[model samples]
Target: MIRWAASLGLILAITLAAPGAHGQSPAGAYETLRLIDGVRVLMNPADHASFASSNVVIIEQADGLVVVDSGFSRADGDQIVSYIRSFTAKPVKALIYTHWHNDHHQGASQIQAAWPQVRIIATEAARRGIDGPARLEGVGYETNPAWEALLAGQLRDVAARYQEAAANPENDAWRRHRFGQAAQQSLDGIPALVGTRLTAPTELFTADLVIDDPLRPVHIRHLGRANTDGDLIVWLPNQRVVATGDIVVSPIPFGFGSYPGDWIETLGRIKALGFHVLIPGHGLPQSDSAYIDRLIAAIADIRTRVGALAAEGLTLEQVRERVDYAEQTAIFGPSPARQANFQSLWLSPMTENAYKEATGVPIVQGQGELP
Candidate 1:
């Protein structure tokens, strides 16, 4: 999803998933996936219902729990707090953000409320973005009323689109009604997001930061730029579990303002980590490099294609029309919903960033997108 696209911005993350549900979804709001003895990922929040959030991971050390990706809204954080309380009474020691995307870090306030002493950590660059002016009137959206109104309005607009589609004889009646219901489901989440405070990470490191433990040691590394300028991946050597923020999202990836070559190399480095269990920012837990390998190939394919197309002097939109990775739809579920997700969330933005790389255009954060 383009995190800060000009017209729609983060709203696309939800609306684009129209018929507003995951094609292959977790039955509950969030599922607990036990990687080893102490590692758990509170999987996808099917219960959130509106905006999509990154998967919140819980890693247990001897004394306390270490969490990755606090989630999108405070309500999401509340669900996470309840989810954690349902399992254990261990105090949360640290809340780590993989990147600065709103879906990954906006819920920090709720977690902070739960564990007042929880150390919120991010890479130096990510820390800047935690409080960066991503959207709205030159400020982050969580605290921006206009941005929130714009988002709610966009979802409403989508609902109207579906409603109109339902009445049209040209579109499928069943599809329209199904999608309309989904749009409404997303709109139902408006109240939960108001007055969200964008809590910035407290601690920062440029390269590596470690939270040492006898049982489960966390080795946090900023492995180049992938999903964002400062992307953090948590590696627990003892447990053999690695938490990849948005650097690796299962189901489908988000390519907004991502670095194509850097992302490919970063994933390659992640593949070399020899992790027994990989918890992506969203979706289910991964066991091997199969998904990582596929992601690498998919990205390389787009980079190569876009580089070649741009060499021919075609504009980004022209390149977009000429480029097609629909074959990847087979790799990430060929359902209509999945296809839309793959193209919009991953393909479109990946091609744009790769084009910038090839043409020597600066891909500024929150700038290379729809504005």
Candidate 2:
């Protein structure tokens, strides 16, 4: 399902057959998937009904837990805290953000409230995204009261749309309605959409940062820009598990604020890591690198095809029309709904980015151009 909210600067696309909602308790609002002894994947429904499409990873240590990706709202953070408490009484030692997307880190405050000593780690670019004005500028908006009002209104509108859609008997509509209800519920807690004390990263790194502990040794690497300019991947060498935030989303990938040309290379580096299990920022975990390969091929295909079209003096619009993604569409999902979602969420933005890169135009969103 594709829903556009100009006020929020979002083109929300919820995928089908998202991980089922389980382990729901007053403490955590998401489902938990235990990959190994100490590593648990806390997944939000991909249908977007819960408005928590991002997954939170929990890694157990000797003293406490290390969490990846806070979530989307204050309520989400509270649930995460409760979820953590339900399992163990240990405090969260660290909170790591894979990127700077709001959905991944907005709930930092909640986690911080519970574990005051937790260290929030992120790439330097991600820290800027949280502390600076890039988020508003990236979306072509300015940070101000008007912007906040627009976002609040957009959330309300989304809630209403979901409510109407939920009234339908169709399964997809019900999912949309559920997502809308969650969006509405999060409004009271999210403050303003952009411009707030967004629990900035306490620990920042440029390329790589390693946490060497006796129990769980974490290797955080910023491979290259993929999903976001500061995209980072968490590699648990011993566990052989990798947490890719939006960098390797399942079902369909997102292309907003992405570096298509560089993303392919970044994926290559991620593949070299040889992770046995992959936990994405959204959707379910993957046991192999099949999804990663598919995503790399899709982006590379877009760059090759769109770059050629753009080099031939074709405008972005023309390139979009000329680019053929039938094979990819089939591979992703040939159904009408999946096709629409893929085109809107991934294809269009990717084409534009590839076209700009090929033609020597600055990529607007991740170019560090702030107002």
The sequence of per-residue lDDT tens digits that candidate 2 reaches over residues 178-274 is 5445555545433525452257788999998887768788888999888788999999999889998988876777777678878999999988988
Which of the numbered candidates is closest to the native, going by highest lDDT?
1
Question: Model 2 Cα displacement at 333 (Å)?
Answer: 2.6
Model 1: worst 10 consecutive residues (lDDT sum): 19-28
**Global local distance difference test of model 2:** 0.70
lDDT of each: 0.73, 0.70
Clashes in model 2: which pairs?
A: 27-82, 49-178, 49-179
Model 2: CA > 4 A from native: 1-11, 16-28, 46-50, 132-151, 160-197, 366-371
Clashes of each: 0, 3
Tens-place lDDT digits, model 1, residues 72-149: 666778888998888889899999988877778877888898899999989888876655545334645346786566
